[model samples]
Target: MSEAKSPQSTVDVNTMTAIGAPRYGDGSVLRTEVVVRPNPRPDEILVRVRAASVCQGDAHLLTGMPYLLRLGFGLRRPKDPIIGHDLAGEVVAVGCEVTGFRPGDAVFGSVNSGAFAEYACVSAQRLAIAPTGLPLEEAAALPDSGMTALQGLRDVGQLTAGQSVLVNGASGGVGTAAIQLAKALGAEVTAVCSTRHIETMRSLGADHVIDYTTDDFTASDRRYDVLLDLIGNRSLRHCRRVLAPKGSFVSSAGAPGGDWAGPIVWMGKIVLANLFVGQQIGILLMRPRRTDLEFLAGLTAAGKLRPLIEKRYPLAQAGAAVQHVLDGHAQGKTLLVV
Candidate 1:
């Protein structure tokens, strides 16, 4: 981690550049604008964001879809207009109540909002020290996707050593992280992805790789103890077909069904089906926490896990970066460098 830098002696603290959306819409709604720099609350810290990563959640929020989300996110407009989550940077100022961090400490964690900017105010509780020797961009990429993978495999799937696990959509940010994490947990990993990503999946420690273009993984006789579905394209019945009896099926992805409905209808269906089956069928809603961030940081520091960054965009091009993630072709993470 970097020592705290003295912003008072080195830089101006008035205004900063940030990406903000005036109203919920497509990526074009996002624009780079100058805004007043924020101050840390009594329990918060002011961070000069060096880097941040774009996630599917950010894309979903940009549209304010499912209308249900708007209940808490803002019915007419986002409650907080600035949107972003994963961030890695240096703390330039700490609130009086803050103790674990000081100015200049490099940290990585999720922000509730306002991360696509030169500076952001994050609660001390949401952050952890960045892994030693890890670049800010890579560290920034780890929090959201990495935590989702860890929680899904360990907490939801109950994956155990020597268990057979299959990761669907094995090329995206969460899928890549899941592959490595499942291996780290001693599970034999089978990754399902497109033809081009087979080698990439294998390189990430997958014991087997299936190209979805040439083969339907659900049609195979292979049975897995846990199926981590990052692509919700398949039906629940199809997914259950590949699961071993009494095994777990965790779904983390779904297609947008309706403006107000979103994936809730599908998730409800899974819940209903669970009543008749012996297998575990459910959806994963990833919650970000500081302890999980620290645990993942430890793994990264020990070289047990690493984030795969597919592209980097400067602050000025943040809109394009978000579009790339929305397009659903990025092999790993897309980062924004400040």
Candidate 2:
């Protein structure tokens, strides 16, 4: 561990190009503009962003969706205009109180906001050293999706080796990460995706690939010990039918039940249903941790875990990258390279 500020680096920290949403609406609201670069606080570090990923959460923030979200985001517009979370880059400055990292360290992790810019300030607790052998683009895609899958399966679903596990939406970012992580955990993994993505899922070590186009996994006679529902498209009853006794069902996504309620209504339904059943059912709200990021980075360094990147865009085209994700058809993670 080291402390003390290094000499002034190559990156200029005064001002930078950033993408911001003038108003909450659609992807169209995102605009590329020059903004003052962020300065790190006592427990923070300033990163010159090399790459950042577009996430479904970003789209939600962009639209101010479910109305209730507006409570935390903003009443009439976004509170923090610049949006993005996952980022990998070089540290250009370190706060005086920071230790174990200094200027010139390559790090990757999550942030509260402002990753879609040349520079971002993140809490020291949320970051870890980037993996030795991973590309910055791929590392940038891992934090949010990787931690979500890791916590959803291992912590929430309580997955055990040799148990049967099924992952829906197996081609998207979280789905792909879940598939690989499930396999790494020694579970019998089944993935559900479109016909075009069947091979990709299989390549990721899925024991079985169900083409949702031609098969209804819920209608099958097979029962799984755990079902990680990433799409949230099917009903709770339908999902329950496919779970074995004492199985766990984790809900991570779906359309908002109401503009004001968002996923709260659906989560309530799941909770009420769990009262009479032996099975476990709940929504997965990911708690990002540095330990989880380090674990995933080790897996990446060892060649056991890999991020699937679908496309890349420059900082100026960040809005388009977000639109690609909002389209609901991206095969993997989308990136905004600075």
Tens-digit lDDT string for candidate 1 (1-338): 11212122214558888888788877777877777899999999999999999989999898898899899899898889888999999999999999989888999999999999889999888899999878876799998999999999999999999999999999999999999999889999999999888888988999999999999999999999999999888888899999999899998986557888888888888889889999998779888888999999988888878998999988777777888888886898999998
lDDT, residue 10, candidate 1: 19
Clash pairs (backbone) in predicted model 1? 4-103, 4-104, 5-104
Residue-pair clashes per candidate? 3, 0
State candidate 1's TM-score.
Answer: 0.94
Candidate 1 at 62: error in angstroms? 0.5
* Root-mean-square deviation of every model: 4.9, 5.9
Model 1 regions more than 4 Å off: 1-12
What are the lDDT scores of the predictions, listed in order?
Answer: 0.89, 0.88
| Backbone-clash count (model 2) | 0
Question: Which residue pairs clash within candidate 2?
Answer: none
In candidate 1, how many Å is residue 73 off?
1.6
Model 2, span 165-265: residue lDDT tens: 99988899999999989988889999999988988998889999999999999999999989999988899999999999999999898646877887888
